[model samples]
Target: MELTTLWFLIVGVMLIGYFVLDGFDFGVGMALPFLGKDNTDRRLIINTIGPVWDLNETWLIVAGASLFAAFPEWYATMFSGFYLALLLILVALILRGVSFEYRHQGKGEQWTRWFDQFIVWGSVVPPLLWGVAFANLVQGLPIGLLPNGGWIYEGTLLTLLNPYGLLGGVVMVLVTFTHGLVFISLKTTGDMRERARALATKVGIGAILAGAVFLVWTIVMHLDHELLWLIVTCAAIAALALIGGFVANLAGREGWAFTGNAVGIAFALLTIFSALYPYLMYSTIDPAFSMSIEGAASSQKTLELMTWVAVFTLPLVLAYQAWTYWVFRKRLTRETITAGAH
Candidate 1:
């Protein structure tokens, strides 16, 4: 494959990693009010993801950096166009990370509650905005090229608040919420585990419903694309995976449930990226103004150099993250939390 296409796939892989890993982290955070019945329950829930939430977040950083490096023009157009939305996501992430650290350091219960709220909002905002943002990308943006070859976004933030975009946000929220519940079920024991599993089954239905609409909308929008079949296949698999996850959760199989949801999330993303192939950013302003992958990518030499660096570093990063998860693999319990044995 050409370097430009390779980098596009690499960027897609990094994004899929972010969604698959941090997606559950987002799920766990959003689940706070639902699953956490008491301070002990809350702490147990938090501790389930405490060890690796930040680590999972690293994939976003890598994805962003890779986007900037591999497709500078695409990066520029998206960052500038989605500036306000991205800023909100950034602030939410920072607040969420801070809440994770400072919630325990509070002097009193009220202080901790404040941070807990932050954690919940922080988890909720990013995924919703991310969904809106990506949905807009698939739906096409009002972007146009300038005389100087610069790109300009002709729409405002409010323009992204359309029905389709909002539905995309809702779908993401439901998917991640269910994903987190499954994670909780996978990583906890006794009543909490069973509660999480039950909740996941309930929420997974919403995820399936909303995800079906969003994916169908996406496929319909791209019916003229040469890769329509790829998009359709991915969307079909995503729907099945989500239903399979719901069934697995019902059957008392937390591991398979989590895996199924993860696969669902991954293929949902694959459906989007597959639809978005060739054009990094589609232009609703004018089809001629859309940013193609070749038009937006960095030079061949830069891509080749970055590919070499990734070849050396990517495996090591994967190995270290795997080891970290393995080391913290034991299920958490309220008894353990009460016994101070995190």
Candidate 2:
């Protein structure tokens, strides 16, 4: 394969990793209000992800680095164009991380309570805004090519708030919440497990409905051909996953329920990427000015060198992640949290 193609594949894999890992993190955060009904309940939910949350976020770092290395032009354009939105996501992530660390440090219940709210906010805002930003990118933004052959974005916050963008945000939030619920169900036992299972079933159903609507809308908007088929397949898979998860939850099969949720999230992410194939950023004024993989990729030599490094490093990353998951495989319980045992 050509170096550009290799880089594309690597970036694609990194994105898939982000979806699978951070996808559940987003879900857990969204589920905070419902799953963490009490301090103990909150502890159980936190414990389920405590050991792995930071590790899960590594995919985003990889994706960003790959973008910078493999498609510097596209990176520059996107970063400048979507600066404000990206800044918001960064702030939200920082808040969420800080809250997670400091929330339990103080002895006072009130301080911890405030931090919990921050954590939930931190979790909820980023996914919603990210969905909006990406949806806007796919739909096309108002950007002009300058005399120097650079792009200039003339968009504001309102410009990013189209109906389709809002729909994307809503879909992301719902899907992530359902993902968290399924994970919580799998990683806990007793009453907390039951509650998580019930929530997962309910959210899974809601996600199906939301996903269906989004799919229909994408067709109506006349997305690109390559994206259309990929999205269609993802929608079908997501529907199946949602149904399977619901059934498993009903059957009291926690493992199956978790699997179903994971599949659903995987499919949902595939659908999004499908809708965004080729074009990383679309121009509302002129389709020809849109940024695509071919236009945005790095030099052949750069991609070739990166491919070599990827071959060796990617497996090590995967191995480390697998080991981390295995080491933290025990179920989280209320007693463990109360005793401050992770």
lDDT of 1 by residue, 202-288 (tens): 898889999998999998888898999999999999999999999999999999999999999999999999999988888998999
Cα error of candidate 2 at position 257, Å: 2.5
Clashes in each model (backbone N, CA, C under 3 Å)? 0, 1
lDDT tens digits, residues 34-61, model 2? 8777777887787788989999988898
- Please provide the root mean square deviation of candidate 1 (C-alpha atoms, Å): 1.1
Pairs of colliding residues, candidate 2? 27-176
Q: TM-score each candidate.
A: 0.98, 0.93
**Best by the lDDT measure:** 1
**CA lDDT of each candidate?**
0.93, 0.79
Give the best candidate by TM-score.
1
Clashes of 2: 1
* lDDT, residue 2, candidate 2: 62
Residue 121 in model 2: lDDT: 82
